[model samples]
Target: MILPCTSAAQDGWLRLRQALWPDCPEAEHLAEMAGFLREPDKYAQFVAYDEDGQAAGFAEAALRTDYVNGTETSPVAFLEGIYVAPQQRRQGWGRALVDAVTAWARTRGCRELASDALLDNVASHLMHRALGFEETERVVFFRKELS
Candidate 1:
């Protein structure tokens, strides 16, 4: 089953988020999760659970009024992250999570959904395609720091 992330206290959501972004500290994750939870109009997250009631995957999305690389809409729904436990992959969890995000975006009047993956993450690219996302453009961002 797929459920909306209504609380930052949901352990399953925290665990799956940590799995997807292991390098982030637990405190940082909690802080960000709290921030997201506070902004229901701008952010949405969903967690997928197996029949055994264990977290199998999760997806996070944000409504961005700022320019999103491939979308023409002003407030595009941008998928921030998604992950399915290795053992639970290919079991429809990812698709269900995206479906939840899609429904949430529509309610907010978003006309398009956009997402990105590292240039080398072929698996994510394929998954996006399978979920009905069309490739719009490829971009390489550059940054410089002045000391």
Candidate 2:
């Protein structure tokens, strides 16, 4: 079953978030999730639970007013991240989480939903395609520092 992440489920969500982004500091994860807990309308996270009431996956999404790739509408629903346990993948949990986010976005009057994955993550690319996202463009970013 998919349900909105509650304040009481912060630790569960943290575990899933760390699994998806191991490089991110635990403190950073807590700070970010704290923002979600404070603002339910603009930010949202959903957790998928198994029959035994254990978290199996999660999706974090938000409303983005900035320019979003492949989107022609403003204030799009942007999927910040999603992860399903290796054992839970291919079982429709991921899709259900996305569906929940989509429903939430619709309630917020967003006309489109957008997401992105790293250039080298082929599995993520394929997953996005399976989730009905079409490729709009690919970009390789560069930066220069000046003092």
Error of 1 at 77 (Å): 0.6
Write one digit per residue (lDDT tens) for candidate 2, span 1-147: 898977835546889999999999989988889888898989999999988888899999999988987899999999999999999889888889999998999999998989988999888899889988888889878999998
Best by lDDT: 1
Candidate 2: stretches off by over 4 Å: none
Q: For candidate 1, write residues 20-131 as lDDT tens digits.
A: 8999999999999999999999999998889999989999999998888978888899999999999999989889999999999999998999999998999999999999
TM-score of every prediction relative to native: 0.97, 0.93
Alpha-carbon shift of residue 25 in model 1 (angstroms): 0.9
lDDT of prediction 2: 0.89
For candidate 1, the per-residue lDDT at 13 reads: 91
